[model samples]
Target: MRRLKSVVTSAVLAFGALAATAGTPAQAATEVRYVALGDSYASGVGAGHYDSASGDCKRSQLGYPALWAGVHDEYQLTDVSCSGATMADVRANQLSALSTDTDAVTLTVGGNDAQFSSVVQACLTKDDAYCKTATDWMSYYATHQMADELAALYRDIKARAPHAEIAVLGYPQALSATGTCPVIDLGSAKRGYMNDFADALAEGTKAAADKESVTFIDVRDAFQGHGACGSDPWINNLSSGTEVFHPTLAGYIAGYYGELDGAWS
Candidate 1:
C-alpha cells in the first residue's frame, strides 16, 4: 500500500512540473523599429534643440521624428536624416539605415534635387523677375525632370524596407497666399509664386508616394494660415538668417507632428 502511494505521488508531481513548463509563455516580441530618412526638413535645421550627436546633419531633438518617438514608447527610432540630403544623398548614405526589421519609415526629400535652396536664395536677393523666372524654371524641372529620380528612390525604399509602412511628408509653403510681412523682401505676388513652387514640389512628391503606394501627408492645408507672412507664422522668416525659410519648432509641433500623428493613428 505504501509503495503504491509513493508511486502515485511521484506521478502527480511529474505531471504538475510538466504542466508548469507548458504554461510558461514565450519571449516577448521585439519593439517596432522606425527609420527616418530625408533632408533638412526631416533633419529639423530650424526647429532648434539640435541633437548633440548629429553633427552637420543638424538633427533636432525637437523634430517631428523625435516628437513622434517620444509619444510612441514602443518604437525604436533610427533617424539618419541629414540637413542637405538630396534624393541621391539618401540613396548613398541614408538607405543603409533601413533593414528588413524596420517596421515604419518617414521621408521628406526631393527639395534639394529641385534646387530649392537656390530658389529661396533668388527670392531673397534677386529682383522679382529673376526670382519669378527661376521659380518657374525650377517648377518645370521638378515636374518634368525630377520625377524619374524620385520614383526610383521611392521604389528602392520600398524594396529595402519591404514590410515597413512608409509615409512621404510634404513641404509647407514658405509664405502665405496673400501677405506682405516681415522677413524676406518679396512682393505679395512673389510670395504667391513661392507658394506655387511649394505646390510643384508637393505634386512631384505625391506622384512618388503614389508610385510606392505609400501615404502622402500634405502639410500645405494645415500650414495655410501659419506661413511666414501670416498672423502666427510657424516658419522662420528671413530674419532667422542662416535658418531662413525653414520651419520653426511651432511648425514641427503644430504642423508636421500633427499631420504625422493623424496619418499614423
Candidate 2:
C-alpha cells in the first residue's frame, strides 16, 4: 500500500507539472517596422540600379536601407528616399512617407543643399585658381547654414516617427585628402574645407538626434580607410566615371552593414 501510494503521488506531481507547462503563455516575437528617408545617397544613386517604377527617387535594392532590411527578419521596410532631397524635402515631402507604426528610421541629406552637382560642374568648367575660390565659398555656406537646416530636418523626423529608433547617416569623404582628381584638383585647402563641412554636418546631426534621445551612428569612422583616396575606394572620383563622386556598391555595403550591426546587434 505504501509503494502504491508513492507511485500515485509521483504521477500526480508529474501531471501537475505538465499542466503548469501547458498553461504558460508563449512569448510573443517583437515586431520592427523601418522607414528610410533622405537624399541621393539614401536612394542609392551611384551604388547600383534603382527601382524603375520609383522614377527619379532611384531607390536601390542594394542601398543601405535595403541591406539593413535584408538582415533583420522581423523588420518591415518602407523606403521613400529620393535622389534630390533637401532638408525642406524631409519636413515638407518625406513626412508623408513615414507611418505611425514605424519602429526605426534613418536619413542622409544636405549634400543637395550644397548643390553638389553645380559645385562639381563649376569645378569642371573653371580654371584651378577660380575653382578653389568657388569651392571654398560653397563649403563655408554648407558648414554654416546647412548644419542648422540638417538639425531641423532631424527634429522633423523625430516628430513624424515618434516611437522609432532614429539614425542620421553622414556622407562619406567625397574628395581624397591625399589624392587629387585630375579635373577638379582638390588641393589641401579645398579638401580641408570639405572634410570640415562633412564633420560639421555630422556634429549637427548628432546634436539634433541627442535632443530627441535618438541614436546617431557615425559612418565616417567605419569608412576610414575606404575614401576616394584609399586603395579600396568607397566614393568614386567624378573623373573615374559619369556617376561623378558617388559611393560604389562596396561602399554602400560597408556603410549599411556597419549601421545594421550597430543598431540591430
Candidate 3:
C-alpha cells in the first residue's frame, strides 16, 4: 500500500507538471468528495498499518476505504470512521465529515450498536447455554431496537450529503455456518450463535437502507468460503486484544472492496 501510494503521488505530480507546461487547465476532473463513516470494520481495526494521526480511530491503509481512495485519485477522501464506533458515535464524531458537496459515501455500521464485539467475547468465555441465551437476546434486541437507530442514522447521513452516492455496507459473518475451528475458542453452538447475530444485524441494516432509499451492499456471499473457520479464513480468529474476531486485511478486500468496486467503477 505504501508503495502504491508513492506511485500514485508521483503520477499525480507528473501529470500536474505536464499540464502546467502545456498551459492547459489541469484535468478538470469531477472530484469524488468521498466521506467514509462507520465502525471498526470501516476503520480497519484488525488490518494493522494504523494511521497514527487518527489516534484511536485505527484507520489503516489496507482498509477498503483507503484502498478505494488510493486507487481513485479524484477522491478527496475524508474518512472519520473509528474503532469502537456505534451509530451514536458516528452521528457525534463522523457525520461532520459529510456536507452538501460530498459526492460519495460508504458506511459500515450497526455492529457496535449490537455490542457485537462484547457478544463474541462472552460467547468465547461463557458456558454453552449461557452463551446461546445471551447471544439470542442480543440478536433480537439489535434486530428490533437497532433498526430504528440505523434508519434514523441513514436518514441523517443522506440529509448531510444529499448529492452523494451512498452505499450501506453489511457485516460479514465472522464464523462459518457450521463446524468449529481450533483458532476460535467457541464451541460449535456458540459459533452458530455468532453467525446468527451477524445475520440479525445484516437484516436490520438492509431494512434501514431500504427505508432511507440507499444502496444496501450485502457482502454475505463475498465471504462465503472465507469465514473465520474456513480453510482460508478472512476474519481474524483472535487478536492480541486489538480487534478480536474482526475481519483481517484479506477479509476487507474480499468482503468490502470486492463488493464495492462496482460502486465506483
My TM-score estimates for the predictions, one after another, are 0.87, 0.77, 0.86
* Tens digits of per-residue lDDT for model 2, 29-54: 47577888898888877776577877
Predictions ranked by TM-score, top down? 1, 3, 2
Question: Among all windows of ten consecutive residues in candidate 2, which has the lowest summed lDDT?
Answer: 3-12
Pick the lDDT winner.
1
Total clashes in model 2, counting residue pairs 3 or more apart in sequence or in different chains: 0
After best superposition, candidate 2 residue 171: deviation in angstroms? 0.9
Question: Candidate 2 vs. truth: CA RMSD?
Answer: 14.7
Model 1 misplaced stretches (Cα beyond 4 Å): 1-29, 178-180
- TM for candidate 3 is 0.86
Clashes of each: 0, 0, 0
**Which pairs of residues collide in candidate 2?**
none
Report how far residue 14 has shifted in candidate 3, in Å: 17
Q: All candidates' lDDT scores? A: 0.81, 0.68, 0.78
Task: Give a tens-digit lDDT track for model 1, residues 24-104.
Answer: 543235767989999989988888878777899998876778767655656677899999999889999999999898899
Q: Write the per-residue lDDT of candidate 3 for residues 141-194, one digit (tens) a residue.
A: 777888888989988988999899999898888886554566545567777788
Q: Cα deviation in Å at residue 74, candidate 1?
A: 0.8
